[model samples]
Target chain A: MTHRSVFVVSGGTGITAEAIGNSMLSQFGDVAFTQHSLTYIRTEDDCRQAVARIQAAAEQDGTRPVVFSTLVNPTHRELLNQSGALVLDLFGTFLQPLEAELGVRSSQKVGYSHAVRDPSAYRVRIDAVHFALDNDDGGRTHHYDKADIILIGVSRSGKTPTSLYLALQFGLYAANYPLTEEDFDDLRLPEALQPYRDKLFALVIDPERLTVIRQERMAGSRYASLQQCEQETRTFAAIIGRYNVPSINVTERSIEEISTRILAQTGLQRRIR
Target chain B: MTHRSVFVVSGGTGITAEAIGNSMLSQFGDVAFTQHSLTYIRTEDDCRQAVARIQAAAEQDGTRPVVFSTLVNPTHRELLNQSGALVLDLFGTFLQPLEAELGVRSSQKVGYSHAVRDPSAYRVRIDAVHFALDNDDGGRTHHYDKADIILIGVSRSGKTPTSLYLALQFGLYAANYPLTEEDFDDLRLPEALQPYRDKLFALVIDPERLTVIRQERMAGSRYASLQQCEQETRTFAAIIGRYNVPSINVTERSIEEISTRILAQTGLQRRIR
Candidate 1:
């Protein structure tokens, strides 16, 4: 492989950029990727000092550095310019679009308002990016075909979370797909996926449950109406039937029960070992 | 406030599906969500019987039930047909795509694998759907305007995980965005985001440290090289200077340091009471 330059995503408190960068990093394990957050550089001089450190590293290594960052203001941007690294300005990029979409000025500090990543799932500590890439199967498509089991459902049907659990715990390469209105209209499988008929597994839920889910987003929107939800649920059921799709009604099932039952039915192994 | 149905996702060994389902249920504070796993239904007859119960509930409530499930084979799909609930087929959707992309079939019993949502990041339990949504900032631009801080950086810079930590730990509404190549080329803030500059903050990382990170995926891909990585870092630094962006480098800082530093720099109130 050719010698690659260092790509630095600057701007502290940038969790989303961190995630995307982590995701991208997952694709090329060979690249040496490091992330730093400039948390308290307030003045131009402070920025200049920071820039000196960055420039020193680049010059010492003779490697070009690429920086990804969000700045507090225009002067901060200028200070970073002296560092001589390629910069991706997230603030500038989203400033206009975010303003237009929200009808308000950008509050770049939004990330500081919330603290949601919980470390309770596993006894061991894992960083967010490491955990996501370690758990993500976005590029692992073949694993789906080899899966002894499969999950299906509409949005919020619990496919993603469940799949992660299986992969993390039982070593299952579980994959999920959403059933959209378009699929219901044709009442058929996407032509692209017609081959896995025998291996296909379906997840079914009650319309009442779906309506409750939609209510969370738009409590009283026409889309969340009981009648509309009911119709959609019924249509989904009918579509599954028309295709002779095999499925399981998960209305009252627990994760363990579902996995066990599916494994037993298919005569597949329960664990890797 | 319409009568809504509840769809529960469950399956797989090690309680991955169940854990995910638990997360999904937690998202809705006011809804009756029930979980059932295949463990309870051992035979085809048992599956048929379970479907009947679901159907009965739907009929009583005048709503169709939604099912999110992971099953070992298509047989359960047939059994679920006995129930009137609508079905979503995850296996069918993801299996082929994965197979095509990875050139490796999913393991017969690979464990849960939703990697994007770092279950370990938050204090509460979350499922796959929850993980996906956690990354989705509300569509409103003003959403971040009301935010205490915005996180900016490249992928895997610990954005999603950090943001989630802030949200769960403090109830802060955190939103994050990815910085793309296009953003770097343009250098100027995305016109839409021009208004939020005042509240903006940046995250920075050291080039050497970043190289350490990129090495995990491909070890030596050009994209992951220190030289290439350094160039990116310099570019980012320069852009921040040009735009006068306020930023921080997270090269050697812990999450606490980075998070606390951001809070101080932005002068935002801590979420904890």
Candidate 2:
């Protein structure tokens, strides 16, 4: 129950710091965390000013702050090392050995991870994103041929977001289809999705959670009713079972876990590095 | 141009490899990159086998492979270091120095970054993704009160994908509204969005690109015509300027660039680390 302050500091966009912080959170459980990016650290004064703020915060808390940093520059990293916080220098720890192993110097550039210098990879991601949107909720089922994976699920069962996540993160063409009342009544896969059977994945959620999610969208309607949710989920489960659809119960899973599981299950290649 | 093979090897999911590869791509431009994940290397044989594969690949190409790795285990890393390829051990370079700075040892467990051990952060991301989908293209304008930022643009101008990317990557509750013909004719902000003017951001695209994109969706129609695309884009630009809304021309930019710029412009806090 002890309180602690965690600061994720970076010389760039702080994505590395955020990622490391996420890992730390997963390992250590919950802690109050803040993110700071030293994106404009041009001079020694700027680096010192940034460090001073971390020092002041550590002093106020009466505990050494835990700072996760990915500052690529040596001068900026040195300034952070002078702070009262316990610094985890991501780039400093990794770059030299990397340089030696590669027999070439590391670029040591800031904001390189999410930089848009490579238009081709960037374009791949954008196209995938557009594909996800175009095919969301069975909107454009004819494009299933283009999709790497087609996620089928009842309404509000985590299909849309998971599809988008797969698209954006991995540049996978993910299309999602909602199992409607007609499909459930017949207990069959939709005709359009039949040809792409191998490309199909299913997402299921707890009926209770599904109801709650639907209620947020449409309060007091049959679509949001617990009875309808239970029936739809039961029918959807049968449909997935009949078709041998690779499925995940999303009630307790994150989109990362869902997408990773989908990729692993389907043995699909991510288009981007 | 010399053709070189790039390998991303990791004891966990090869996210570090993907990230570093992205940076390398930005700095070094294009190369043939491959990802090989050594997820569960529990023995010497596992390490040796992985290393041999890399050596074989390097030999085939007549060039030492540039390997970006996040292998946490010492024994496994040593095995890879012996390979003929140029190996960059991401964790090896960083962990010890981080351990010294923090006065503690890292767990050195693999798959730490995308691990679903922290349900709170996972839930936050899921909720944000759902929010983004729920409010997409003004589908549910009432929820604008809850949105961190509402992206407004003409149809097919990269609004939907950007909104979802913001949500998925940063857990920012982004809502997008497609400025329709009715709004354009009036030459004013949509009545529903006026109260949230400060939260408004805009996306503009090249009319030619818009026509091509729309043609893919619905060809040989007014919606896909170059003249219509130009007119809608022109009106949207005027509306954005009239409102003094922060906007980005997505003609030459990628989704990563678009989302990053949105975050920078809005100063919105990402719910995730």
Candidate 3:
């Protein structure tokens, strides 16, 4: 099998290139790819240097690298094209037609996706993040009314990260509550959560996976034991089923998928685009 | 002034459309647009429904709507094109050139960016996010050894959100510590932070902005007072200066800029591309 290298190059934060690279990775698995790389080349000189580096690596490995770039500068793009790699210009392939269709010239600026100039949107995201931290693991339940969505799960069931993702990505106010042994014993939603039932979304994971995650944090404890994890998972599922709470199995899902499913189920609007 | 509506339609997660919309907003202030819009239409029927909705809205105001789309399906793209609106096709204009350059067909899949099938990258991001939450506001200083970067700041100075953003977007292990009155009184770094000095990055903000942020949390407390805010800001600045701690003023900056600058200054590698 021949080894292949994939490089995601960009003029800015490289988010666009990364997104494209991720999409490609999902489509084509890691079978032939030895390296998945990122190069942030902001200027013409940096672009040339990056291309030179790619060329040097290709020469050594005898495998022409695949480059996915979103460089907006024409001069830099020309230099990248001359590098003898399979260059995919994310912007060059699209911007001209978009400009003609919109009846306006493209700004052709780098790092435009996540610019710092928009203070209001930034502030909203920051506030939502702070909310997530304050209300983490049911630290404060009084603020559930203020939350756009409340995530409920057993400990280490991936509530905290999903809460933070929703806040940072969509500027959505998210709060997560951990279901404890007491709640599991009673097999009911917490009294505090009753008022905010409409906003509650449960996240559950496979007992085996939960055991492995817990073991990493605290080995040889009841918390990390498969038996305890199994019990907790069963109780949590019962509660979710009883309440008819919208839930996702986080056993094999990413925070992105969990958050997206919650958003789709709840129809919660993002505070920022 | 005329009221105008802008819609970002995509067959995928709509991230590209959203990025372009945000860039346009920053370039042209929200003079013409009412709200930043996003419509994720994955199926042909969904596309027709979205177009019908747009057509209905356009008929009401006689102002043709502006649609920025990344529909990869030719049938859906054609439907979008016939919506009687000014449509900018992000993928339709770019995929052909990309296909020809690479001599391969595009996948043309919907919701490809955050697909759950690719779990390794997603797992890394989720783990990084968990690390961030575990170490938030110096919650668990013991894990500082695992952190790629540690952010220190006075309270409400935008540390939490930036930490979470760095984790979710790049899968970087980021931890943040809040500088309290006790640390400022002695005019020294927290004893717990001394060992991790190399990972330290400080965040500071304008006294006025810090005061305003605090005021929202605690209306009448001394923490929210301008005098207290000014004193804390000065002490934090002095500490950062004394230690030569790499720092950024987040007063007028977005979390995106703050996180990007932090990553650039620290030279930390993103776990994910």
**Which residue runs of candidate 2 sit more than 4 Å off their true CA positions?**
A1-12, A25-33, A39-89, A104-115, A120-123, A154-157, A180-187, A204-252, B1-12, B29-33, B37-52, B55-67, B71-87, B104-117, B180-187, B204-253
Q: Scored by Cα lDDT, where does model 2 land? A: 0.75
What tens-digit string does per-residue lDDT give for candidate 2 at A62-104?
Answer: 7777777767678888888989677877667656654554455
State which candidate has the highest lDDT: 3
Docking class of 1: incorrect
Model 3, residue B271: what's the lDDT? Answer: 74
List runs of model 3 lying over 4 Å from the truth.
Answer: A1-12, A24-116, A184-187, A204-238, A249-251, B1-6, B24-31, B34-89, B103-117, B185-187, B218-238
Q: Write the per-residue lDDT of candidate 1 for residues A1-273, one digit (tens) a residue.
A: 323343333344444333333333333433444444444455777677767767766786576455555454667877776577755554454344323422445443322211122223221222322333333333233444555445556655545555544433334546666666666776777553466666556677777876776776689997777787777677768866776667766555444345555565666543321
Model 2 docking category: acceptable
| Candidate 3's DockQ | 0.34
For all predictions, the C-alpha RMSD in Å is 24.0, 4.9, 4.4
Shift in Å, residue B132, candidate 3:
2.3
lDDT score of residue B216 within candidate 1: 67
Least well predicted 10-residue stretch by lDDT in candidate 2 chain A: A24-33
Please identify model 1 stretches exceeding 4 Å from their true place: A1-150, A155-174, A185-189, A197-203, A215-222, A235-273, B1-143, B146-149, B155-173, B179-194, B197-206, B212-222, B234-273
Ranking by TM-score: 3, 2, 1
